[model samples]
Target: MSFDGRLLSGISVLAAVVQSRNFARAADVLGITASGVSRAIGRLEERVGVRLLDRTTRSMVLTDEGRLFYEQVAPLLFGIEEAAVSASGAGGVARGRLRVDIDPYFLRSQLSGRLGGFLRAHPELTLELVTRDHVGDLVTDGIDVAVRFGEPVVASAIARKLMETRVLTVASPGYLKKHGRPVHPSDIAGHHCIQFFDPVTRRPFDWEFHRGRKVLPVATLSRLYVSDVGTMVNECLAGTGIAQVLAIRIQPLLESGRLIDLFPDWSGETFPLYALYPSRNHQPAKVRAFVDFVSKVIREPPAHR
Candidate 1:
């Protein structure tokens, strides 16, 4: 109910501990002694009248109540930090740590090559990329923004639509040489297609082709099933099977003739990429900087050499 001096200090220390997962490390972050950090948490727990954390010599974990408390507390803490940063940056310059949650494939395939330029431009900014199979709790994980391809899952967060990438069906030259390219959507059933899973279904995405108002669904023969985007691309490159992937991800390979679009005419299917933040209001400057950078990258892809 109130931001008393001790309560605010305790909250900051608690957030640091949860993030770093160790008292000594948290103390280093807070610039306080480990014993001080301990006393602060003890006071916070006593003030809250619940056990927030259970600690042993080797590890410290959030208790059930602690987890619930953190779910509510972390967002408030993030908002306070964002407010401080906004007020501090009168010139609107982006600074401080900007942690982003993104998928591994997006990181390696899209941002990894261009990140050096971003870092060089904002010398004061500290960027942390947390690559996950699924989006984590933005506030609890201390993530500033989550850029991913799919629907936004966090209902309370602000969602910004970046761009839609086309779904493409591709195969290697060697595979085409051996099995021949499918001339029609129906022909896909006879080819050795590489199956990539749908995260929601935990099964291979159904093969679908679209052209104008027409849609065709094919039951294809998949020789192998892959759980990862990188694996699907690698296997396709090795001429194992045909793969369905986002065009943005395989643009270079397509330009190099390493991968051929099997159904270029049927590339009407697309997926949305969204940038999600913890709150709709009070967005920090650092968050805006990264999101703008992402949009620029998507709009102007690197030319394939």
Candidate 2:
């Protein structure tokens, strides 16, 4: 007949864990100790008559029943948060937790050095930036927006094309001096090239160069294959091998003379950057603020991207 306030507290703790993905992070968000967070979850599990989280020393995940419970509870939590924001007259402000899924290369090359301004502008928002290779379930992962290159994987979400950056095949001067620059794309066969995998295809992306309307698909050789673009860039810079990278990502290096664009004339190939969000309607202010900040940060002079 009466409301159990403790149940609400437990639900809040559960939501925190789902958003933060660990007891320590959840504890920080809730302003409680890690042990306190664990106790809260224990009490919550006892009350619910099933284990909501399967926890190991290194990681934790929602059980099947836990995920179902979370699915039912998540909408209620969102409603409560919206109502609270409205009641406090901060509904339109970017004042809540903002979880962003970003590409590792974009984070390192573009957003890392520029985020201080955004953080200063939105002091009330807690920004969690997660670097991922693929766009997973946004709601289940608690991701507010995904900033990535290439196309959107899911049809349900909204996708905004931010910019298209040219792809350049580059090598350090040291590597080129030793192996000689490839005048033609086919000459790339003899040189060691850093391979970046296509997360969707589960194989290293086949190297391709474009000049005008001509497309040259090179069967490149690689002694090193990196899973992320940042690492591939580093490997290229280290004289390990030639790498095909987004031009905007390495424009500074090219200008600094640390890495040379093997064929600047072959810069016709381009990759598009996109911001994908869970919904088109009632999008959170935090998501909009972040997406806009990213747009401004990564866009280059028309020549660069």
Candidate 3:
């Protein structure tokens, strides 16, 4: 029997089941149903004219012939994956599911509205956006790319600096009008400051201010504290209090006059945003496409411009 496309597909399914040691685990990785995996394996066994697996109710074992076949097939499958990625990246037609882990604040402010445009640009691509306050283990999470605020600490992955984003101290115009505006960072102590806490640290983030060469970290007293960035924006808009947040998200509000910059002269703290992936050696087309798209978005000015 000549090796054709159907045989190759069967071999791939068999290899996944053997490597994962379970149909369910293999299905998860392949993004297929467990029954589909079982059917594929059954077809493969029939085509090969051998019972590759010694199947019991509780578990399965690769037969001697199956073991030999697996040893030969697994490497070829991996090579195929590498080749596919290389071709896809070079062809610039990004397809397949692009799983991304993002900082929640960044999502709320920067990417939420703009995601639809990216998907429309590449109709063959599917996007999975996972957001949280704390950084997760990329391998365990099956994340293709991770977008994070501040510097990344993943030594194994390739980290690309997307941008250095400034932190802005801002308040709603109504809130500022009612409570009055502060000219200096020190003057914020008298206002109702809405605070955000780091998810991993569980401590309030200190407001950062820059004046010439000196960087100042101020711990302002706050009656309102929130864990989510969206909530902080809402509270500020509702005239609940002043908030210090990333400037990227608040640019529209700033331009529309919904929020007023608290200390423009002292805005100095810049945080690094990183796009992280498994390795730089053979980056997947979907991941590379997403990184390039996001970089373009960040570099472009707000709609007001």
Q: What is the TM-score of each candidate against the true structure?
A: 0.88, 0.76, 0.74
| Model 1 C-alpha lDDT per residue in residues 1-305, reported as the tens digit of each score | 76588877888888888877789988998899989999999999998899988987666888878777876777677677767766776536778778899878988988887898999988889998898677766655666799988888777667989998999999999999998888987898888989988675687888899888888899999779877899999999999998889988989999999999988899898889999987545677788889999888888845921
- The list of candidate 2 runs beyond 4 A from truth reads 1-14, 22-60, 63-80, 132-137, 154-157, 199-201, 279-281, 300-305
Q: List lDDT for all candidates, in order.
A: 0.84, 0.84, 0.80
Candidate 3, poorest ten consecutive residues by summed lDDT? 134-143
Candidate closest to the true structure, highest TM-score: 1
| Cα lDDT, model 1, residue 86 | 65
Off by over 4 Å in 1: 1-3, 54-68, 86-91, 154-157, 199-201, 301-305
Q: Which residue pairs collide in model 2, if any?
A: none
Residue-level lDDT of model 2, residues 1-305, one tens digit each, is: 99889998999999888888888889999999999999999999999999999988777888888877886776676777777888998887887778898888778877776688899999998888988778887755878889889878877568899999899989999998888899888899998988898887788887888899999888977788768777888888889999988887888899889999888887899999998876435566788889888887765463433
The positional error of residue 16 in candidate 3, measured at the CA in angstroms, is 6.4
True-structure Cα RMSD, model 3: 7.5
Error of 3 at 139 (Å): 0.7
Give candidate 2's error at residue 11 in angstroms.
6.4
> Which pairs clash in the backbone of model 1?
none
